[model samples]
Target: MVLASALLATLGLVSPVSAGASKGVELGASDTEGVTTSATPLRGTRGVSSYEGTGVPSDVTAYGAQRVPAGHRIEGYSSPTGDDFGTQSIIGADGRVRVDPTTSFPARATVLITRTVSGVERLHCTGWMFGASLVLTAGHCVFNQSTGWYTGQLRFYPGANGTTYPYGSCTAATLRSNTGWTVDGSPDADYGGASLNCSIGNTTGWYGAYWTTASLNGTSTTIQGYPGDKSQQQWIHSDQVRASNSLRLYYDNDTVGGNSGSSVHTVRADGSSGCSGRCSLAFHAYGVGSGTHNSGPRITESRFNLVIGWR
Candidate 1:
């Protein structure tokens, strides 16, 4: 099945939020009696309508009550021949993707991840921080056909400069990906987005950093990721990037696994603050690194807006 095909079905799926809900975290506090006493709920354009009669997977239901470890791995990799692509690399001793020296890209958000199966740690993938609590990443990085929601420890890094900054971790209580992602094994789903709330701050991590949202559509973008199977162990660099109609990214640089979910940010030609350049360009979220898809669906903000309510 073609992954992009699922996205075609998504265009008609945009639906508004449940009235007065924000992207991820609820902006206010609640009182006793299960009543929410916060101010006007942070509102946004509604997301896709909820799926009906779709229950959680049996495996997820079985393990939902248990807390898995912070480190886990999942099985399976994207087939390299088709539109989907990734490499085989094991997690390093540093609890990160083993880098390939050859590949490079402008690094933006650093992600922390853990995977589990039958309540056992199985696989892990890094994630990139987006909005205040939003994270962009590959859908497969955290989800699997057998394990369901790969939960353990989720963290983010602003910049990876060895030991200079420590790592940050958060418990991902909620997760969401494109509904079409499961329809086929396409990078189309790679342009996925997620949101996370950090209760514990890690100075060496990304939670403490500031992030601003940009608009989508025809924006100059940059990306950074860890390609464990590439020539570099931990890769970081910048390049002129473009977003495709499929919502996937097409840049001049190279990327691989572990780089999945890497954040794509808007920048100016001179590499200055804000997204506007010499032209009357407005900076905004371009697209997320879902995976390597020459012809796949791209991750759109409308879909992400839906997930924001989930967190």
Candidate 2:
């Protein structure tokens, strides 16, 4: 009874999702070629081993993020929670729990993104490893409708602990997004990704994604990645799908700036048809201001195939 009693607390489920459409999209997604199963995580190899910010990368100097300075965090509101953590009003009393060993499964697969501006680098957005050299993130993370693609302004750290470079870091070989966001600036299409120069996914593994023409309203979703308030430390929260529109998903899983691009995923049992394990349902992109629920671009058949082709 003790373990059972502790279950809910351990899960730290998020508040109820707001009511909305529940219909799904057949994403025509991944397999031997579709979903790539996560692998056994490797220990921190970039710097010396320690529980916290002990591992060091050659290029990084700061170990933790500042209190998310204004103009530093996000580019703009409802753009992508990647850049700002202006106040707890956005995250809702911080319902997130920290993941101790950053080297665990999907935690190791999640990524910390840093973007440089005006000669300074800061915590930017969250990312999910979807291929050996590919990391999928928010559309705004790599492209700005006003200024244009961030090109060389971003750096990626997989399984990055507060100050550690457990998986080292990698830069983009190519930054990619669809015309929906790049040209149209659609929030429902606010998703993008990077093809890294290194094949880190071979060791860190990657997330599996799928889509279907069914309702996703009740499927439990967990959002875990680097949060701004906790410095560069990884944190997590969970909730069921609040609603799923043709191009986006809404949920109550608390998130803020620096949490953008985090995977909104569900754990499916092994041997499931198309996707199993840590199967991602959508990209976490916004907070409450985006219409009563945190939301992000939901993968569709074309979107899934497009991203997979990039991988």
lDDT digits (tens) for residues 1-311 of candidate 1: 11242344345442323222234212211111121322333233112211111122222213222222323223333324323233222211112323332111222235434444465532255555433345556667656566565555443433333222222234464565656564554555544445555422112112111122333344444444544342222454434434455345454334444555555444333223212222111111122233532122333443443443343
Count clashing residue pairs per candidate: 39, 10
| Alpha carbon deviation, residue 275, candidate 2 (Å) | 0.1
In order, candidate lDDTs are: 0.36, 0.70
Model 1 deviation from the true structure expressed as Cα RMSD, one decimal place? 13.3
lDDT of 1 at 4: 40
TM-score per candidate, chains pooled: 0.47, 0.73
